[model samples]
Every structure is written in structure tokens, then in C-alpha cells.
Target: MKSFYIKIKSFFHSIEDNIAFYPALLSFLGFNFAMLMLYLEDKGISAFVIEHAPPLVINNADTAKTLLSFLTGGIISIMVFSFSMVMVLLNQASSNFSPRVLPGLISKRNHQYVLGMYLATILYNTFTLVGINPKETDKYQLPGFSVLIGIALTVLCFFSFLYFIHSISKSIQVNSILEGIYSKAKTRMIRLIEKEKKESPSFPDTSDWKEYGSKETGYLQTFAAANLINICKENDLQLKIIPIPGAFVLKEIPIIKASKAIDKELVEEILSNFNFAQGEIVDDNYALAFKQITEIGIKAMSPGINDPGTAINTIDYLTELFAIRLQKNDDTIITNEDKSLIYINTINFSELMYQVMVSYRTYCKHDMTCVQKLFIMIKYLLLQQTNNDHYHNSLISEAKYLYDDATANVENEEDKRRIEQLYKSLPNKRE
Candidate 1:
């Protein structure tokens, strides 16, 4: 039963991540609200409004029908245009930047809400239009107040359209995208740092721990951490996640190490808590942001694009991220208050730094601007707060790699001179 519950929760999370969730939900709300207005209309809401304020009610059946029909058509047109704009946005982002960014943009709640509002407005007006009759003898039964509401909703949508345009334009800008990614990555990192300081613990030797293979094959994206914690606490077992978040896992591969051998049923329940999917979502995994930023930098440096400015911006964000990372320990350990339950062996700081710096050294080494920025970025990280010598050594090592690339590939005498001077200026012990 717990396994079934986990699957249900997992399914709901996937549904919630989809772009259509909000639109479909708001559409249902719109339908229900239309029925509600009809109920109020049956209760003589139009008569009450007419008695108090005559101008607020729409008594003429032809006027109500015409207005609702016209607004409904107009809303449909607006929705069509909005969807087209979104498609174009996705295409440009995927082609020019990186395809990974599309998930972030697609899962944007604001855009979803705007599109949902458009759908809701359309459905509300269309349903209200169904009930209007020219030959109804009673003016109070005309759904006059309801027609007024649809008109008001249309006016609100006009404003929403304006907001949507402003927001979408800003979202498409590369700076905004970078900042958003940076902010999210920083938040996730900071949370980890706090956890390390407070609840972290040294675990007993796991060399003898029983290894368990995954039953499914896909990229391990989100781990249901809260649910896993409950299961661990209740079962009095410790779990170690083998592959880091954002890693592709295969069936019958050892992806978890349990403190003891467990029954098949328990193993299935534990594995069900891990969500595997095709792509990465940045929110659950900060590593994806690092990867996304790196990919954007690589795309910019590609010959077809030849846009060095974007690459420089990406370097700036990565520099700040790395600096924050210096404050992190080499390992990530999540535990309950008693300092026992979960041990997540994440990609260590050294490995993450090596991966990111190697990519920059590979792709951006030819561009003097980008390579020089890499030199300075390494210099800045070397000065940040860290308790580990290995992390410091990693930065120094990355600097040496950048220097070697700059020396071999950089052709301009002046740029080579600058690289020489920059390499000389590194922190003395780091040499």
C-alpha cells in the first residue's frame, strides 16, 4: 500500500510539472464559476442589481448575447496568438541557447497562469453565452450581471495580455535567464551548506552495506526526499543514494546501498521513491543549472553562433556560483535530528569544479576574452572561504589547465602577454 501511495505521489508530481496543468485546472474553475453565476442568476441577482443600480444590469437579451459572443471570439484570438508566441519563444531558446532551458520556461507558473486565464475567460464567456435568450419574458432572468462579469473578465485579460507581453519579452532576454538560473542554484547550494553545518554526521562503515539495483531505466531527476525520510525513520534503516541527482540510471544497476539486506517488497518500496525521467529540472538539482550555464557558454562559443558576449555573461554567473561552492564541504550528508537516516553521496566539489572548468577550457580557450575571464574566475575562487585544501588545490589545478590552453592556443602576442601576467599573479601557495 505504501508503494502504491508512492507511485500516486510520483505521478501527481509529474502532472504538476506539466505546462497544461494550470490551464486545465483554471478551465475547470471557469466552468464551475459559470454554473455558479447561473445559480445566482436563478436567485434573482440581476433583479437585485437592477433595483439598486439600474446601469449595472444588462436587460436587453440581444446586447448580452452580442457582447458575450464578441468577447468569446476575441479571447479565442488572443489565446491563439499567445500560444504562437510561446512556440516561437521555445524554438528560439532551443536553437540559439540550449534545449535544456525550454523546461524551465515551459514550467513557468506565471506564463501558465496567463494562458490559463485566457482559457478561463473564453470558457466563462462561451458558457454564459449559451444561456442568453432574446425571447425570455422576464428581464430579471436575462443573466445581465453574468454578462457584465464576462465583460469585466475580458477587460482584465487585456491587462493580462499586456503583462504577458512584458514578462515574455523579459524572460527571453539572456540576462534575465542567467540571473534566474543563478538565483535558483544559489538557493539550493545555500540550503546544502546549512544542512552540512547543522545536521551532518559521520556514518558507520558502509563497505559491507547491501547493494540494491534500480528496477527502471532513465535519468534520476528528483528524489522524494520527504517521503524517503519518513520511510527511513519508520523502518530504522539507512539509505545511500549511489548516483548523484541528474545521472542516468539503468535497470539492474546498483543505485542504492542499504545498511542491511532487505526483502524484495521493501526494496521495491524504496526504489519507487526515486523519480526517473528523460530530462533534468534545475530546481531539484543545482547540478543542472551548472550544466545549463556551461552548455549556453558552449553554444555561444560555437562557430555558427560566434557570440562571445553571452559566453562572458555565463562565466560571470559560474564564477559567483563557484565562489559560493567554496563554502561547501566535499561531501553532502542529510540526516534527521538524531544524525541518522540518509546519506547522499553527491558529486563532490572537486569533481564538479573539474567538470565545469574542463568544459570552459575546451570550448572557450580560443577566445581571448573568455579564457582570460576563466583565469580571473579561478583567481577569485582561490580567495573564497573554504575549509578544505583539496578544493583549493582543485582551483589551482584548474588555473594551470586554463594557462596551458591559453599558452598553446592563444595566438595574439598581446593576449599571450596578458595571460602570462595573469598566471604569474595567482596566489603564491596555489602555484
Candidate 2:
């Protein structure tokens, strides 16, 4: 039953994460509102409104029809144009930036709200047009108030369209994208820290455990840790999940290991709480932010793009993110109110640093400026540390790799000398 509830929750979470979910919901509400207005018109509600409310020039059916018709046509054109612009933005972002960033761009709430407003306005105007009765005696059927409402909504949509344009234009800027990712990742890290401060159960020993494999193959997007903890507490078991949230697990591969051998039915039930999907979602997994930013930097440094400035900027944001992450404990355990039940194996600091920095070093090695920026990044990170020798070693290792790449690839003596100067400036340069 717990697993079933988790599945349901995961289902809704997936839906909520979708870009169109809120817009579709708003459109549905708008459609219902249009219907209610028409129903009120049928009951002579508009007549009372017309008599008591201020007079509208478009009170007549013919005028209402003309206005609604024009609005419908204009809104349709605006919607088409808006959608086309969105597609163009997505295409450009995917081509110019990393494809991983497409999810963040697609999930912008402002864009969704604008598109939903357009949909609502279109539905409201279409319904209002149909509600108008042109016959001489059908005075009560002409929804004057509804038509006025439609006009007001159309104006709001126009303004929203303008805002959408400004918002999208600003959003596409590379600096904005990098800052947005950094901000989100920082926020997630803070939340993790707060959660860790809360009283947690002791970590359980899982030395002697039976491995449980997955049934399907895909990127493990998320899992219900709390639910799994509850299940473990109830069954008196300790389960250690093998892969982190963003790992790709194949069928029959061990994804979890249990302290005691469990029945196949119970194992299947436990596995149901995990969600596997095709793409990485940064919202669910903060590590993906590092990956996404790294990809953007790599893409910027590619021969085709040849934009080392963007790569350097990406390094700046990455350095900030890494500094923030270093302050927080890695997410690797979960427990109930009283006892630890689930232990997740997460990427360690050294491995995560390598994963993030190695790509930049590999791709941007030939560019002296990028290499120098990387050295500065490592130097900054090393300064932020106090006694974490392992992390310092990792940073120094990265610097060494950068040094090796520069000496091998940079032909100009002056460029190589500059790189060597930066490398020597690092606190722990190898002899």
C-alpha cells in the first residue's frame, strides 16, 4: 500500500513537472468559466447586468459578434506566432547551448502562464461569439457582459504577449541561463542542508546484503526515500540503493542491496517506488545542474562554437556551485522519525569534482584562456577549504591535468609560459 501511494505521488509529480500541465489546467478552468457565463446569460443574468451596470457600446449582438470575431482571429494569429517564437528559441538554445538546458527553458512558469492566458482568451471569445443571438426577439441570449469580459481578457492577453516577448528574450541570454542554474542548485543545496540538520536515525550496516536488480533500463530520475524508509522500518530491513538519482541502470542490474533476503513479491513492491525516465531533470537531481553547466561550457569551447568567453563564464558559475556544494553534506541516507532504514550511495566530493572539471579540462585544454580560467577556479576552490585534504588533492589533480594539456597542446611559448605561471601560483603545485 505504501509503494502504491508512492507510485501515485510519483505519477502526479511527473505530471506537475511537465511544461504543459499548468497551462492545460488553466485552459480547462477558463473553458468552464466561459460555459458558466453563457449559462448565466441564458438565465437573463446579462439583462440585469446591462440594466444596472455601466452601458457598453458593444451591448448589441451584431457588435459583440464583430468584436469577438476580430478577437478570435487576432488571438489565433498571436498564439501561432508565439508558439513559433518559442520553437525558434528552443531550437537555438539546443543548438547553441547544451541540450540538457532545454528542460529548464521549457519549464518556465511565465511562458506557461502566457500560453495558458492565450488559450483561455481564445476559448472565452469563441464561447462568447457562439452565445450571441442575432435574432430580433432573442435579446436575453446576447451576452453583452460576457463580450465585455472577453474584450478585457483580450487586452490582458495582448499585454501578456508583450511580457512574454521580453521574458523570453531575457531568458535566452547565456548569463541568465547560467545564473538561473546556479541559483536553483544553490537553493537545492540549502534545502538539503536544512533537512540534514533535522534529527535523523543512525545509519545501518549493510555489509552482508542480498543484491536486488532492476527490471527495466533507464535513467533513475527519482525514488521515494521516505516511503522506502517506512517500508524498511516495517519489515525490519536495511536497504542500500546502489545508484544515485541520475544514474542509468539496466535490466537485471543490482540497483539495491538488502540486509536480509526478501521474497520476490516484496522486492517487486519495493522497486515500484523508483521512477525511471529517458532524460535528466535538474529539479529532482541537483547534480544534473553541474552536469548541465559543464556541458554548456564544453559546448561553448568546441571548435565549431569557439567561444572561450562563454566557457570562462560557465566556469565562474560552476565554481560558485561547487563551493556551495562543498559546504553541505552529500545526500546519501534516509530514515524514519526514529531509525535509519535506507542508505543511498552517492558520488563523493572527489568523484563529483572530477566529473565536473575533467570535461572542461578535456574539451577546453587547447584554449589557453579557458585553461587559465580553470586554474583560477581550482585555486579559488582550494582557498575556500580548511582541512579537507582529499578535496584539495582533487583540485590539485585537476590543475595537474590542465598543466599537462597546456604543455602538450599550446605551441606558443608565451601562452605556455602564461599557463605555467597560473599553475605555479596554485598552492599545492607538484614538483
Candidate 3:
């Protein structure tokens, strides 16, 4: 309830949020105008006189008193009527479903339009109360009084027309504006892919690459291989592993075939000593394969921030890859050094990825929209991931570092107290 009140207050404080204010003001204006018209009619000067002001002053004492009463009463009644209408609109419009009509009215640039309509309403109602019907005026009504009522009604209708227009304007789709933001995000993704490509090595079309086998000949594999080749070329590194026919063997395998043909004695000796099977091929590009696999897997995981389901699906995909690699007999040969760099582009990254699943879960469990929570969580996770790349190997270590940095910034008493409280709230640190 307190949070709700706070939001309501903040909304009213901003001019942009005036959608809830204008309709209310309009109703108030309308009622006030009606009362003013009533007062004008009660005065010695008929609605006709007020409608058509005489050039010469011919006011009697009684006429002056009557006019004064009419003016006072009409103004008071209009105020009351306006207030009543404002209350009605406020009660009718639910914030969750309908746009606040009152605020929208206040947002308009034309105050004169608002004033004129309400003023006319008051004049018309005042004239009517005084028995001056414009349509029936020809029978017995004074000209000015009857015409004033007609004028008031016209003003009321004009205000209504403007309100209708404003309603339509407010209802216009805002999706294009949202789409513009998404466009920037798409561009950023494309740029990142391009940058990584530029920085990475390309795969060589050697016989060794063929050893990863044709099963690797997919769009994702091609892109990953290209990235690896680009990285190698940029770094001036030797082809870490040469491509060969039929399935890539791990880089640690000592019996790789040379890029060019070598002496049979040396090839046979090396292959025989390293436990090579007669049919086994040497030029396996395990480095390229691993790097490519990890990169593609990360790309698939990137969309999980806004969508929990996407994150879960991505995690599942990476989990399969990790499991496959673990199951392979040669996988045990992947050194700690090689595994560290590869995981960033693969399954390990998902453990620290944004808790999109948690956000959706919270939303379902609680009545909250969770949009803001999801946004903050995603932003924090991205920052943490980037920082982890900067200073640490594991997610847990990076998270601890972040907590330490945050703790070090405490200066004031309030901040120190908050820090202490936060420290207490933290989970036990993993050794």
C-alpha cells in the first residue's frame, strides 16, 4: 500500500503523467460553468441581457442586487458541479486498465479550449434553469437569455469534441518507439560479432580440418571455425592443430600429421609410438573445434536476459555440449589452461548468467510485474560477467571480488551501517 501511494504521488508530480489530472479538471470546469450560468440568470438582467450586453448603463438598485446574486450563485454552483464531475471520472477510470483521462487533459497545450467549453456550459445551464430555452425562446423568452443558453451548449459540445480527439491521440500505438530501441540492440550484437571475427583467426582449408569431419560442416561450425582462424592469423600463431580426414582428435595427441607430407619412417614411427590405430588420422584441429563450439554456444545464450525460457533452453544446449565433451575419451586430455579460456565461450558462462528464470518465478509467485526487477538483475549480471573476464577465472571468485569492491566504498555512517547489514545478509563464502 505504501509503495502504491508512493507511485501515485510520483506520477502526479510529473507533467508527463498528467493523464490522470485533465479529465478531473474538465469535470470541475464543467460543473462550475453550469453554476455560473445559473447565477447570471437569477440576476435582474435576464440571460438575454447577459448574452447581449447593452452599451448604456441602465441598472436599477433591485436589478443590481439581482445580478450580484446571480453572478455569485452561478459561480458557486459551477465550482460544485466541476468538483462532482472530477470525482466521477476519477472513480470510473481504473489505472491498470484505462489511461487516466484527467491527466491527459491537463497535458494539452490549449487552456483556452478548456476554459471556453466550461464557460459555455455554465452559461447554457444557467439560462435553462431560468426558463430560457433557446429552442422555445420564440414563444416567450428574451433574446439574450435564450441565445446565451445555446452558446453554452455549443461550448460544451466543442469541449467534448476536443476530448474525443485527445482520447484518440493517446490511444495511438507506441510500438514504433520501442522498436527503435530494439534496433540499436541488434546493431550492437552485429558489431560485437564483427569485432570478434576481426580479432580472431580463420580456419585453414587443410586436410587436417577435414578430420573434424563433415559432421562439423554446419553454419555454426563454419562461423566458429572462421573466428578461430581469424584469431590465429591475428596472433601470428602456427596452426595449433592441422585438419585431417575423419573426426578431430585432441591437440594433446602427439601424432598429428604435418601440413605437408613428411618421411614415412618419421610418420610411421611417431604414429606407432603414440597409440595410433591403423585407420586413425593425425591432422585433427581440436583447438579450432573447441573454440568454435564455445563461441556459438554463447551466442545462443545471449537472449536469455529478457526471457527466462530462452536462458533455460540455452543452458540446456550448453549442458549437452559440456556433457558430450566430458564423455569423450580424449576430453580428459584438455588441460586446465585450455579449459579456462574455452568455458567463457561455453557452458560455464551460463551458471553466472542472469537469473531470468528466477525473475519469472518471482512474478508468478507474487503479483508484481517484475519488469524492473528483471532489468536490474540482468544489468547486474552483465556487469559482473564483464568484470569476471577482467579479473578472475570463475564466477564465484568474480562475485566475491564485486562484493569486496562494493564494501570498500563505504564512507559515511549511513553507508557504513548499510555495508554492515549487507555483509550480514550475504551467503557463506565458498572457500
Candidate 4:
């Protein structure tokens, strides 16, 4: 029974995701028109007279037959038109009105297609109703009470359709699905590339290394990290063994005590495990060698948003001295979930970097610092990471500048004060 229920749920979910099944606005209008036609015929209204009489003129039908015909025709038209208009509004809401709405459904291109389909459906229904009406039929006119009720029912249907559409739009979560699909596709592509790398030659005879960079913060880093993980796993190699395929070290630093480093190397040899590229080698009392390598690793990991040169410079800074600062605090790497979220954040940052680059090109005067920080916050949110003091500060600074300039969403004093306080506490400089 459980299995059957799961299958049923899955079936429904599949149906819901299928855009073709929804049939756009046109399909709903067509269905409503058909139903309206059925209702008219059931009420003993002759189609021939309905076709001959002008739709707007209600008083012309004197005979009972003519009146009944007119009443059904009018009601049907009203119902179909009413239903169609509600559908148009609902479709627009789904496509535009709010970010919370089904924005994924309504691209400008799709909007045009949907509008055209709806108009075609409306016209087809209108023509069908007009063409099928009777030229001459003895008609028992619908009484005033029946006509009034019909009009009320039409109004009810209009509102009812709108309500149903609104409910569906709320429940659908189109944007989430779109985002998830995009993420998954990109993830899979990264996996595929890593798989190829694993299947190919390793180290000395390395394959062509393609550079991926975008102004977006996390984009390239997330992809690179994921690929690296996959490659290591496929080759049955730990990261400690290979580190990154391409990491350039600008400086050296202390990693561990000489005694510990010597012991670690001895243990590796005894175990016949050659994972370590180099153990911590303590030379001068000042620094350790492996520490320098680790710092280099972190530098290699730093994603350069939108510029390779920027990335190279970031790596240069992550040398042993500053790399210590880059080390994830125990609090930062609390769980596997946290790591996964970080990866996502990294991806978002990359995208933001790209967006910032585009915005810079378009609007030369926009503040880079403000744009960068806003996107950095956006990345943090995407990653499901805590809005730590650093992010909060950056956001506050940006918000204040925007507010001061009478920018968007900065309305009053309370907001300004809040922004000021946040900026006051958060660090102004980035590592």
C-alpha cells in the first residue's frame, strides 16, 4: 500500500511538471467554452436563433423560444468571456506581478506565446458560439429569475476560476524547480568533466587545463572544487596526494614541528601510502614548509570573480603568512551540510560577480563595493550560511549608501539607523 501511494504521488508530480499538460490559457478558455455550450443546449436553447440575434440586444427576444435562446447565448458568452479574462489575469500574475509568483513560467517569449494562444482560443470559442446558433426556433424565453441566476453563476465561475489559478500558482513553486534543474544540470556537467579527467592521464602528462572564470563569485570555484573532488575520487587518490593539478606557490612557510613532520613521513613510508606530496618540513625556527603548501592550496582555491588576474592576485595573498587567516574556523566547518551550502554560496558569488561585471559595463558609475557586497550577501543566503559579522557589515555599508542617495527600498530613519549600526560593527576591509 505504501509503494502504491508513493507511485500515485510520483505520477501526480510528473503530471504537474509537464508544461504541455497545463495547456496554457487557451486550453482553459476552450474547455470553459465547451462547457458553456453544453449548459446552453441542456437548457433547451436553440443554437440557430442564438446565432442570428445580436448578442448585446437582450430585449429583442419576445417569444418564449427566442427569449430562452437569447438568455442561454448571452449567459454562455458572458461565462466564456468572464472565465477567459480571469485566466488572462491569473496568467499575467504567474508571469509577472511578483517575484513570489511563478516567474519561471513567464519569460517575455513565453508571455507572447501564451497571450496568442489565449486570444486564439477566445476567438475560436466566440466564432463557434456565433456560428452554431439557430436562425429560427420556437423558443420559450428564460424567465427573469432564470436569467438573473445565470448571470450570477457566470460571475461565480469567473471568480472561482481566478481563485483556482491563484491557488495553483502559490502551490507550484516554479522558480524553485527552475533553479534546482539548472543547479543539477551544472553539477552533472561538472561531474562529467571530472570523470573524463580521471579517465585521462595524470600529473606530468596533464591534459589541457581550461580556465573558467566569471564575475560571479561562486561560479567557477564551485565548479572547480566539485570537479576536483570527483577527479580525486575517481582516481582513488586523496587530495593530500595530489593537491590541485595546478597550484603555483609564491612563498614558503612553516607547517608543523620538525618532530611531528618526521614522524608523519616515517608512518607514511611504513604504511606504503604515498599520499603526502611533502610532509611538514621545519627548517628555520620561524616557519614550516607544509604550512606554506597548505597556504598555496587555499590560494589556488580562492575564486577570482570575473578575472583570472584577480584570482592570481588573491592566490598570491594566500601564501603561508595570510593563509592562516583563510583557514576555516572550526565553527565554520561544523557539518557536511555546511560544506554543501558553502559550495552553493560559492556558486552564487560567481554569478553575482558576473552580474556586477555586466552592471559595471552598463552603468560605469555604480559603486563596485556596494554591488559586490550585496551579491556577497546574496551568496551567503544561497549557501545557507550564517550572515556573519562580515556579511552583515558589508550589507549595512551598501544599504546606507543606497539609502543616503535616496535609492530603492530605503524609506525612513529607522532603516537608516539600523544600517548605520550594522556598518559600524562589521569589518570594512576584505581579506
lDDT score of residue 364 within candidate 3: 25
For TM-score, the strongest prediction is: 1
For residues 8-89, write the lDDT of model 2, one tens digit per residue: 9887776665678878988898899999998887787878876776475255777778878998889889989999999999
Span of 10 residues, lowest total lDDT, candidate 2: 50-59
Best model per lDDT: 1
**Rank by lDDT (best first):** 1, 2, 3, 4
- Which scores higher on lDDT, 1 or 3? 1
What is candidate 3's TM-score against the reference? 0.24
Please identify model 2 stretches exceeding 4 Å from their true place: 1-7, 136-138, 199-207, 429-431
Candidate 1: the clashing residue pairs are none
**lDDT agreement with native, every candidate:** 0.86, 0.83, 0.35, 0.33
Compared with the true structure, what per-residue lDDT tens digits does model 4 show for residues 1-431? 54345445544433332234444555566556556654665565543334565352232234333444454455456446644654665565434323222322332233333333444344433433442334433333322222333344444444544554554454334333333223333444344434433333222211222211111111011122333333334343322211121122112221111111233443232122111211111111012222232222223233432332322332232222222211221121101211211111112222322332333223321333333343343333333333234433333344344333433334556655654454344444222
**Which wins on lDDT, candidate 1 or candidate 4?**
1
lDDT of 1 by residue, 90-147 (tens): 8999998999998888888999999999999988998898878889978887999999
